[model samples]
Target: MSRPRRLLTLGHSYVVGTNRRLARAMAQAGAGEWEVTAAAPAAFPGDLGPITLQPEAGERVVPVSVHGAGRIHTMRYGPELRDLLRQEWDVVHCWEEPFIVSGAQVAAWTPRGAKLVFATFQNLPKRYPPPFSWMERYTMRRADGWIAFGRLVAEVLGARGIYDRRPHRVIAPGVDTTLFRPDRDAGARIRSSLGWMDDAAPVVGYLGRFVPEKGIETLMAALDGCAQPWRALFVGGGPLEAEVRAWAGRYGDRVRIVTGVAHDAVPDFVNAMDLLCAPSRTTRRWHEQLGRMLTEAMACGVPVAGSDSGEIPFVIGDAGLVIPENDVAAWTREIDALLASPQRRADLASRGRARAEAEFALDVVARQHLDFFDNLLMETR
Candidate 1:
């Protein structure tokens, strides 16, 4: 009757909606099967809590940070990990950059025969180092496992000698399909709230961190060039607040950029748009992880158009139009095609919804996690 040997999932950015949504999915799916423990980084502004993994069962664990990655952990980085490995978890799952090494370190710290897992939830190519990490090899070196959200990460890890030949799990991160599903009457409410010009004006939208790497400037430039009467909506916030606001100011009434809304409000905003635009650039800083916004938008049955960089091609498959990163001409043409031909947009919407359910639905993604957990544990036994 004891819980199946308490599996611990430690990661940073757990407070973010993307991570929280994923944890909630795992919790709902695993339910009585496993006691899920999650760890997150220090509280930031608007962060709900330091240790939150589904409804405060308090199963969540937030260990102190020691020499952790990022700007804050300048010196004592990777220090607090001793506590994590000392717990001797059955598996250690890390999210994002340094955590792969962090999890690898934890796995190495554990007694022999424990499983190690690390996932790249964000797009890797977007913010890749000048020289990609040979250090990553060392981080994943001792690990016995990996889970990539898309083929992008899968290919990277596979090349690193981490994903091949072993028990590979392809459980992608998911959106809240329940919340993001098509709403026949959502158009009025969202438009009214935003003071948008009736249902006639084509509204292009995006939801993500407001960093320069997101290619928002390119989006703004394209929006200016768009011949058709159009409006663009931007959601979410991040480090590059001043630059984003400055761009929005120039457009005045033409652009409706509402920065920093609650994460839960994303679906409402997403459902209001006719199309989701991700004009991400292939920069030294970021290529994109998986573009969670792309999936979330499609889940609401909205059409999607994005750059062909990173995991977008892997995620969207045949669902939407994929264009070159900085191609304003392509954006203009694609937008024109969708706005002029409702049928094509409808077709993409249908394919997008179907694709979301098949690959990124919370239930589907959660079950995949559980099944992988079961299989990995069985192998261990």
Candidate 2:
């Protein structure tokens, strides 16, 4: 029997529940044909616990940390990541963007003949200077393949003169269908527990960070023009928490704000919603990469309405309404239309769920990755 091929993945986001689901799904798809080891930070940006893989997942987790969370981000792998690279492997996948110096360092340590794959969600058309640009140049020269989370991201790379230099394709990260699926009973129970049973208003939900780039302000303004009997649920915390709280307070019961919910609990919150809004707007420094919450909401059979910023329209793709970014009137109109037409909302929910199952399901995306890896291996052989 041929020995299984070894695969190493370096990423900080693996500490999140969504990425953990992907790791597990990939392991299941491997079926002894591949061995997967994920190296992750002890804690990610908003992680609540240590990085650890479930025992039965059939994958390994190597804990590593980056330096200076406040500023000057650099991988603190020391000699550990380099030592791991010395071993023979079929592939080394880095989830960080190619411009990131840390991922470039991993490429530097990787041995010859091991395919290096770089994954990125950067949609901003910006250029780096000095050592960072040099690192990006090195990755552009060395990376065997590139996986962009969205088409816009790939376009941004092309604008920066990185495409055609390496083989690349757009492949979104996957979602766990089992975890995010609709459950009316659970939804009802959660709403009842949260004192929402008495409120028959159509609820519009937002689940993500409360920051300027998220366009929460525009959502807030749209909500002000919304008619009575419509409530909004904002679930997340970030720089604009104070502003969000004040806005929610002005609306009283019409706006409910919850901060710092566990990742596992997100599904129940999503299920309680009639529609989810991801009104992200692009700034010079930031844009919506994939607007993952939109997919998660869709997976839970909740219709989504997002602004046409970055990949929101591409991600929604007829599954939900796509409003122009920062256009409060458009957001208001779309929200009102969805709230008034139950049939339209149901249709959108069905389409969104189908889209999630076909494109964002963990198994489906795992197979996509495996196929790409298999192709690369075949070419090498």
TM-score of each: 0.82, 0.94
Using TM-score as the measure, the top candidate is 2
lDDT of each: 0.69, 0.82
Model 2 lDDT per residue over 1-381, tens place: 999888887776675545766667777898789888887666544444444433334458776666543332454455667787888889998887777767788878888879999888878877788778888888778888888889898887866556567777788888889999988777777677667863488888999989888989998898888764687888888889899998888877677888878888989989988899999988878888889999999999999999988889989998999999999998888888888888999999999999999999999988888788888878877
Over 4 Å off in model 1, which ranges?
1-5, 41-89, 96-101, 121-138, 162-166, 184-187, 238-252
**In model 2, which range of ten residues has the least summed lDDT?**
47-56
Provide the global lDDT of candidate 1 against the true structure: 0.69
In model 2, the number of clashes is: 0
Those runs of model 2 whose alpha carbons end farther than 4 Å from true positions after fitting are 43-57, 69-72, 159-161
